[model samples]
Target: MAAAAVSSAKRSLRAELKQRLRALSAEERLRQSHLLTQKVIAHSQYQNSKRISIFLSMQDEIDTEEIIKDIFKQGKICFIPRYRFQSNHMDMVKLASPEEISSLPKTSWNIHQPGEGDVREEALSTESQREKETWLLITKWLRNETEEGVKTWQAQPLLLKCQSN
Candidate 1:
């Protein structure tokens, strides 16, 4: 009974949050996303990391195009998730340039995903050897409270492990 209640609560909260995010105006969303990108770019972890795994933004989420461009500008490798239907999992594909992203097809879920042939063998091998290094994963969170006050939505970097081995 407790588990069921918790699950229900979580579902309701997620729906409410998604609605709130959808309500954000284009200008406000762009402003917040730019600020968030600036924060990540200025962080030492992002600066030192050689490879980063970042998600392509949906219509309602923070736009990561600027961050991706900056990463390439800084000579860092950028990767995005390419879902595999047979394995029911995602693989990281090296994104050499921002323009390449548009050439990919959209998944059933309406998110852009790289094709199976887009995998980079070199990146896969290097990921295993760099397990000890910090890698950035860009993600979004809702209703998080900060030192200043409550924030409705935020995009931030989360440290993640490399499972390429």
Candidate 2:
């Protein structure tokens, strides 16, 4: 009974906090979001690794350009996720330039994407949806594995759309 009460109180507190945060103004939300992202990057555990694999967050609209650039600056190799329709998951690809990933297309729930291409060119958008702006990426870790002829270390799968055959 004591544990149950504690859990109930915690849930109530959490709900109240969520409600208050949701009531924040759009500008305030953006500011808070930026700060949170900065904090996460600052305290990230993978900072000095030789390679880092980051499965980009789909739900969050945080821009990873600066972070990607920073990774390159550290002389680390990074990778992002590419969705394959033939298989039901994402395939990892090494990133060459931070500026190359111009825009990420929403291909699935919480999954936005920028494909591998030349660093000087931008990824063309094939969709008209405005809410689909965030892109999912997978960074390289210490090593890579060749599974079934595809490369991966630790990354997730499909976003929404399948790769064109």
The number of the candidate with the highest lDDT is: 1
Candidate 2 stretches greater than 4 Å from native: 1-29, 55-60, 103-165
lDDT (C-alpha) at residue 129 in model 2: 23
Candidate 2 per-residue lDDT over residues 46-138, each given as its tens digit: 443444444554322334456677667878665666676667555555556666555565565546455434232111232322222223333
Best by TM-score: 1
Lowest lDDT sum, 10 consecutive residues, model 2, at 155-164
For residues 1-165, what per-residue lDDT tens digits would candidate 1 score against the true structure? 698898899899879867887888898789888888888889888888888878898888878889889889999888887888889777667787988888788989898877776647334556454554436465656457789895656656565646555
How does model 1 score by TM-score? 0.76
Instruction: Give the least accurate 10-residue stretch of model 1, judged by summed lDDT.
Output: 127-136
- Computed on alpha carbons, the lDDT of every model, listed in order, comes to 0.76, 0.48
Per-prediction tally of clashes: 0, 15
Q: What does the lDDT come to for candidate 1?
A: 0.76
